[model samples]
Target: MNKHGIISLGEVIVDLIATDLSNTTFQRLLGGATVNVAVGVSRHGIPSYYLCKLGSDESSEFVKGQLTKEKVDLSFCSYDFNKEICSVYIHLNELGERYFHSYVNETPDEWITAEELDLEPFQKSKLFYFGSGTLFHPIARKTTEQAIHYAREENLKIAFDTNIRLKRWESENQCRETILSFVQKADIVKMTEDELLFLTETDTIETGLEHMAKLEIPYLFVTRGKDGAYAIHKNKIEHVPGIPVNAIDTTGAGDAFMAALLSRFHDNGVPNNEAELTEYTEFANKAGALSATKLGAL
Candidate 1:
């Protein structure tokens, strides 16, 4: 029931990533967008709690070990002995583009229920972070809705990443509607350029910001990959140029960006003024660029 730091609610899984171009073998890595952010926050020496369910299998042990190594709080994380492990296969193309194949036909993460959640931590958390993928599942979707309602009732700051993984959802329209509803509830919303376009149905950045601003989300960030990121708030727009790096795999870059952004904001006391928000955004942009230099979600 700590009153500070962040709580990430979503799925946690093992990522089987091909280390070489031949694609014959792979290295098992711990990853999930929310889990990545949680790990990233812990790496920055921040207090973070990961809220999710995992199977009582080797993959689950691996995830717990990685999170423990990162110093993330696992008090709220559960291990279900009867559930199957959730896994993802990452295929990295020559162009550094990563494609995902999820092996979660019937998994524990997909069965998370609202009753299984403990609301005390979230009610007292300074920031509650979540995204779109988990909501694709019925139980997780309901649980997420309840968590959002509780966060709102407690006046806790909400940060949402519209990490739209189309293959995970039922339909594109459902994704947009679900994401937009969460966006309206979030005080800070971060999305890539494509995600923003998809959510807003706007062709231009100018029009996109206009649409997002109408949602009354105090701060909005649009990441442009290697080109860097942009921010919009109070009718002001600013662009932070990206740093050049010989890219390896571009996986988890956005989640890292969100984690860094939230950490910076939490460190800066949630940015009461425009100057503070600008400074936090710039710093986060740098953190994201730094993350891209790394090979994995770490």
Candidate 2:
């Protein structure tokens, strides 16, 4: 196996996005934070692998087809015959903001175990990516912990997104603690301003970053909706303003940002210097801005 690519482990689900609020029209799109990142990396012509569990159903087939079409390696995707497919009902506000109603109570993606994971790819990959949401379930949580340990042992660069979904966790404190633990493990950590507030228990961005800096997190990127994004390394911080666009749906913009950031890092051989980091962050911010211009989760 090649040790120069990326491996993303987490959930993948079908998104039923409402096309019209006035009517019952909706469009089903294959999306999950990890899944979207995989597709985004593939679209950027990077070698990528998606590690997840899918049900033996139509939604599973649809997801597989999309992964195949995008040229993402799905050799590690596990399938379970007993469980139903996972899905999310996305409702968009008039301002283009989105909300979700998840139908993943009994889905296979919530059942990924440590024994089911093949750590060979994690050992070989240059980068390993995962989000905080998958750590909610016991089976998937154990699998994630195992994978992170293996990646650390192999000296693979780990990137984590603090994609905190409040509805999925048992309690706010649990989510914060769990996500902070994972953040401590990551070589690069990405989170939105709101997520940072939740994680650090601070109201302002300066105080939030200060709190995270105390954790000794080497690299941190804070995204602020339409305002822009901020990147911090060592003691230096840089802010990149967001591009203006008529966002019809802000569904996968953050995932797009992460994918582009990782893809750039992967392409640049995981920069070891400040100059390289700056270059990558600028390019990644642009990729994220472009994603917001589109309607779907692409």
Candidate 3:
């Protein structure tokens, strides 16, 4: 949390990815869009700071342990006395796709409100990253809002991933409205083709990028499973091919892609040409593919 590193503000939860919890053993992994990205960035050899509140609980310790194993900076992370784990169960379909089921009402990640958290880490960051997961709760939303404001004021690039967790929100309207609010604050917005349709209420990726463009966001990245990805910036568009992988679970592939892209951006400015964009996109595509080979998010 010192300075001059990437800062990720969002939830870090425990994900129990299992095809059948009753019959088979469930795999435990530290999951959550922001947390996954934080680990992804660190694994990419970037100085990444993961800012989230942990509880004085074993599950929280597991999250910290995962981050520590990845060598992520935890200077801005806090601990809550009344800590509880954000547990989620994931089911896989015939195609290896995942569906999440969560009964947890809350987690300690929301305890770090804007007023309580130290903004110095965010201020010193060259880029700030988040996702829609943080907006599920009011306390976490306030913290995310403050970080966005600070990132914009400092002219630091803001990276966002629209990770819609239906289990976390009470209503779709509430979720959609909050997602738009954060989208307006992001400099670069990353999401899936399906997420683009759901979040922006658009049928096509072009329309989603168009909506982001009108919001003054300079860049947009859309990852389309096996179809690869599309990138639009400054009215320029490019479609990058996807990498083929026998994916077992795509739990955090998109987050990994976001991390790879942000890591590239942190080291070098935005790609200025089709070639550069293609190279960057391919790099991110590999990162995402690598993630799918694993069971959990991070």
Candidate 4:
């Protein structure tokens, strides 16, 4: 909490990815959009801090151990005996495509409150990264909102990733409305092509980018899997080609790209010109493509 680095607040979950179509055999991996970004940033030699409420269950212990092993700072993290870490059962087909089969949680309503958070970490960190995963829960939403306001008040750049999970929200309209509200407050925002279309209610990617450009977001990226990504700033757009790889699993590729991009920003500051934007995007593209070649997110 006293360190200066990237700070992220959200749920820490374990993904039970199926090894076969039967869905009986599985492999447990530390999984969450925010967690992946934190670990990836730490691997880039940046001190990363995580804020969450952990428990004593096996899944919770596993999450704590993995975060510690990855060298993520946990001074801002809390604990609760009654709570339990969330678990997601994912199904993978022969082609390595993943599907969220079901979700399990013992205490979905229990969450760390905004009053429990310390503002010092936000003051010290260079950036604040958040996603929509925890926003569906009212209790967790308050904490996320507080952290965002604190980061803005302190003049730290805010990064928002619309990591949308429709299953968690009551309706698509609610999810869209809630996410767009946060998107307006971000300095840097990232989303997949599908997310861009969904948020803007546009039929094509070009119109979606155009719609987002009107929001005046300083930095915007729309990732297109193996095709690469697009970077938009000040209404200027640049397409950065992606690195091709024989992807076996694409679990955390976007998180990898996000971490690499933020790491570059932390080390060299945000890209101001077209050339600089392409350079940073190219660097992140490689990281993402490489992650897809592996079996796990970490």
Best candidate (score: lDDT)? 4
Error of 1 at 84 (Å): 2.2
| Residue pair clashes in candidate 4 | none
lDDT of 3 by residue, 1-298 (tens): 3446799987777877775534256778787788888888888788888887878788888887878989988888777778686887777666666676544635444467787667677677889998888688788888888878888777789988888877668898898888888887788888888887887788877787776667666788889977789887777778998999999878788888999999888887788887887788888998899889986676
Candidates' TM-scores? 0.91, 0.92, 0.89, 0.94
Residues 158-187, candidate 1: write the lDDT tens digits: 888989889878788988998898788788
lDDT string for model 2 (80-176, tens) is 8865657778777777666764465464444667888887787667889999878877788889988888888888889999998888889999998
Model 2 weakest lDDT span, ten residues long: 101-110
Per-prediction tally of clashes: 0, 1, 0, 0
Per-residue lDDT of 41 in model 3:
86
lDDT of 1 at 190: 92
RMSD of 2: 2.4
In model 1, state the lDDT of residue 78: 62
lDDT agreement of model 1 with the native = 0.80
Q: Please, what is the whole-model Cα lDDT of each candidate in the order they appear? A: 0.80, 0.83, 0.80, 0.90
By TM-score, how accurate is candidate 1?
0.91
Clashing pairs in 1: none
Clashes of 1: 0
